[model samples]
Target: MHQARETDIDGAALLAKLNGWARSLGFSQIGVADVDLASAEPGLMAWLERGFHGQMHYMAAHGLKRARPAELVPGTVRVITARMDYLPHTAPAGWQQIEFDRLARPLDATVSLYARGRDYHKVLRARLQKLADRLAEEIGPFGHRAFTDSAPVLEVELASRSGLGWRGKHTLLLSREAGSSFFLGEIYVDVPLPLTESTPAHCGSCRACIDVCPTQAIVGEYRLDARRCISYLTIEHDGPIPLALRASMGNRIYGCDDCQLTCPWNKYAKRAVLPDFDVRSVFDAPTLLALWGWSEADFLRHTEGSAIRRIGFERWQRNLAVALGNALRATGDADIAQALQGRRDSATALVREHIEWALAQRPQAC
Candidate 1:
């Protein structure tokens, strides 16, 4: 382990100034965390052992090293955890009700609220790097690297340890001030900053998140079966989605926000101050048929610089086809059936199978 060089600097004062820089960069809060995360390793291993990660093999590939920051990034003595609220600035009062209302409409294509914005990975990485540069200017050049939901970092663990917030029962870091509708980013540095005090978990007896999951993904408090999660099925899992969980997916084409939306604490969820998290117009209230109308080229062009692009066109259509199938069963719309037939011949085998399932949702003229 490399030691942080002593520079006769007041760590608390330096952190205060650094917090100012973080605020200017759009971070709502910042906390200093010691790099020792050994205690969290066992739970990480157990979750992997249960295969809760599903097809995300990378979670297991990192093994126990994910809980060890020094192993992941040597010379890291402290991690600066940041929370950036992602609810769009234009999101009105009672936004959760609006989200639930959207889900009730079978024809509406509901992308997760966070993903409707610009790609957060790029936004947070760039801004976190700038925060590191500002720290370098103050303390002279220092060894540091930035991370934002990338690589093998145990982000929620680091955030909770650093007192950004306590981990909610749904397994997301939640703050009484910010709620769960935020993006987390971190800067691993060699600086030995004073650690922030941790907040006590306030979940109490509330099992709102556990009760709200459509797929029953939350097996228990702080335990999740990601394989059964709509968010995981829609965004992370590759190849054919399991048929058992498809009906629970509803019209959520990108990610599911049921747990967070149902959590009473999320009533305190804050809106993003930066325009970078603004909602794209095409996604405002797009119908499943409208998104299905887009050619692969249109998908690429429209989602340019957006996180949804990472899923690529094939998976994009696969998800839409599932939602279209759900819509057919719910709305009994003939236009949706016609749309499914229009694309059946051209779809890839994976998409064709989903298209077949969609077409079957409606019966032929007997």
Candidate 2:
């Protein structure tokens, strides 16, 4: 537990300096959030009470500590929230429609746009650490820690409070300038910075994201049932996907972007200026059979240093199996059945069951 004495550093002026340093490190915007998040706790408890978080026990494990930043990081006074756009450099205009078309293909392996390039956790963490280093140089080694998408912190709550964005109906932070296609990182510091002005809620009378959800996972505005979300099914949950939600998954193998894609604000989604988010050539035209053919060794080789690697081989196969099941029904390709059969004997029980489900999806011929 390291502590630092605060100097006569003016809060407003320090925030302006931080904004410049953040931009030089590829951050699009920065906002200072006050530490008190007591108001958000009831909604957090209610979401957990409803069993909407699925297998992620971590959300409940942290409890109220998530909202209490000072408790998590002793002496924390203000949280600096940063947003960075993640749309790949090569992504064309009308990219939302492009993603929808990929889902329609059924045989194409549709990874969420964010996961196609360098792991955002690695990219954002390194950049945030650099921003911290720059601050320490000027501010005489101030107490600080950086976090990005780590389970314990309530990142969206902090971002919303700091004027980074208003929380959308899908429960993701949405920026008027950058949309929701960006990554958020935070620096918890002991500086008493002036808090950024909070944005007004802008979701007036719009349920486009709610309607377009294939699994209807957005049960209501700002409420997400993670159990039924394809993104959660593919990445977060470690067991077999629910039989009921398998068909609704379509071709999404890594994460689902349906909610973001349908939101009208996303028409203004900004492209990543940094090359770290450039889409890998492997993901440019990902197909089910090509990805399914990857041996465990191949999977390790290709996804090295990637966010997809974190899911491990077993969950990866489970997600692909579900996608193959959907593909079999859509195209009825015998090759897909052959592919499923090839993996049947050696597949783990979790994956084997998904393979069995995929095999059943092959229509019985008259």
Candidate 3:
């Protein structure tokens, strides 16, 4: 609850300057939201009650405070929400089809587009602090904190409330100008800036995102069962991945983008303003076998400074094992089977179990 000196501030003028600063800082859009978020609490409670958060206990640990910003960050009276487009600058036209084509090639490994570059957590958080710094310089020092998917904040709720965009059926913030291919970050400030209006949802009758999910993780409109999501299975969930969902994971070794790939709004998706999101050449078109060949050290060295590194080597190997197993099932390639067999003897118990399951997926073995 750091206090700020009492002073008259021009809210609109400050916002205009803020927008300019945000654009220069690589943010696509900026909006301010009031601290009152009581109306969003029920949905938050219901989502947690259904265990939709999967193993993310932190989502529930904060209780209703996530919906109440002031409580989470004492003295916070306004939230400055930001959107930064992450679509790679080099993505070709019809990129969605390119991603869909990658899924068909089980031999090639796939990492989510947003994660193939520098970790957004690092990129956005630093820039957010910079944004806050500029604000302090504009006025006097003020109470402020920056968050970029690093807290219990209801990010999409605040972003939508601040006129950034609406929550599409896939439960992601969507802008008519930027679609859903962007990263969200927030700056919680004590300054009482003018609140922005919420945008109307524009999902219409489209169900492409729901239909395109390989695991049917989206149970219904705007509802996701994290346990069944490939991104969650590969990155968040630890221990054994549910046996039923392994084959559905395909070659996605990190996060999945099927929903965003199929969304019509993504036709308007914008390219990243900063090169921070450009795809690394190593991950540009890597194969499942190539990634599997990496030791823990290799994984660490190659994925340094990237989001994929956060999953740790065990999960990296575990996820690659599943994709290799699926590849074995699809092509029955002796190389794929041999690769799985090579790792079986040396893998950790968790990875060993997955390797055994993969070996069992061979058509003749079946």
Candidate 4:
């Protein structure tokens, strides 16, 4: 563990420097939190016990270490949490309505807005490390590790406790000003920085997010049943999507954003100041037929620096096949039928099965 030199670096001044650096890196806000996450352990364990995490075995693999930041990163005394807004600058004025309308168009694929650009893991992780490096330069060497959503860190809990925002009824950290259209990152460091005051919850009786979930994934207030979440079914789960939830998936080929789109607070969500989150051409309002035409090489090249690449080409085709199936049922398009026919002999059984399902939806005339 690297230790900082014993010097007179004002902790308050260091925090101010951090905020300035974070803002320059396109981060909306930065907050510092202590290592005590004892209160979050019960909720974490309960969610795991309920099998709400679905196929994300890694969530439970870390055990209690996720709640104990100091244990995850030895010598860590405080965590610096940062938020980066991802709504594209080019997004239309009535983006929420536009997104909802896209969902209704069963023939058009609806990839999550945040994933339409460069992968956030790369964008946030690099910027966070730079923030830590700047802090080290000011205070002399320091023990630190940067983490985005890559680890088992209780990021929203830490962010809320660190005064970033209050947890909304959906259990996401929400700010009256920024809403929840953002990504979170953290720097676990061995410094006792001044903690920020937590903001009060303001969800009131609103349940817009809860009512809009396609799979009713939000089983109750603040509790998400990952097994039924479209995002989980399409991206995380490697097996066939449960038969019960397939039709409700609509045209969501990558991830589901209905909950966030329905949240009233999102009306205040700001566009990204950085170009890293701008929507890529391939993902912006693409038709199911257009995406289904992509070869594996095309998929890899197009998703080169994007988060969608993590699922690989097979899963990518499998998901698109499901969306294509739904589109075939909705549009009765000959192109969709031809596309499904083209992939019926896919190399992977998973892709082949989804392709077969898609072909079954073809209009008899096609």
Clashes of each: 0, 0, 0, 0
User: Across residues 1-366, which tens digit of lDDT does each residue of candidate 4 receive?
Assistant: 454224466777877888999999889999999889998899999999999998899999998899999899888888999999999999988899999999999888899999999999999999999998888787767889999999989999999999888887777889888889999999998877778778888899999989988999988998989999988888899998776787788889999988889888999998999999999999987988888888889999999999999998888888888888888888898888887887787548988888888778777765
Give residue 211's lDDT in candidate 3 (0 to 100). Answer: 93
What global local distance difference test value does model 1 have?
A: 0.91
Error of 2 at 226 (Å): 0.5
lDDT assessment of candidate 3: 0.92
Residue-level lDDT of model 2, residues 1-366, one tens digit each, is: 256345788877888998999989999999989999999989999999999999999888888888899889998988999999998878888888998999899889999999988899999999999998998888777788899987589999999999999999999998878789999999998877789998987888999999999999999989999999999989999987889999999999999999999998887789898998888888889999999999999999888878999999999999999999999998889999999999999999999999999999998870
Candidate 4 TM-score versus the reference = 0.96
TM-score of 1: 0.98
Q: Which residue ranges in model 2 land beyond 4 Å of their true spot?
A: 1-5
What is candidate 1's lDDT per residue for 1-366, written digit by digit as tens?
Answer: 345665678988998998999999999999989888888988999999999999999889999878999888888889999999999999999999999999999999999999997999999999999999999899889888899989899999999998989999999999999899999999998888889988899999999999989999999899999999888888888889888888889999999999999988898999999998899999888999999999989999989999999999999999999999999988789999999999999999999999998878764451
lDDT of 3 by residue, 233-294 (tens): 99899889889999999999999999999999899999998999999998899999999999
Query: Model 3 Cα displacement at 220 (Å)?
Result: 1.4
Q: Give each model's whole-structure lDDT.
A: 0.91, 0.91, 0.92, 0.88
CA lDDT of 183 in candidate 2? Answer: 95
TM-score of each: 0.98, 0.98, 0.98, 0.96
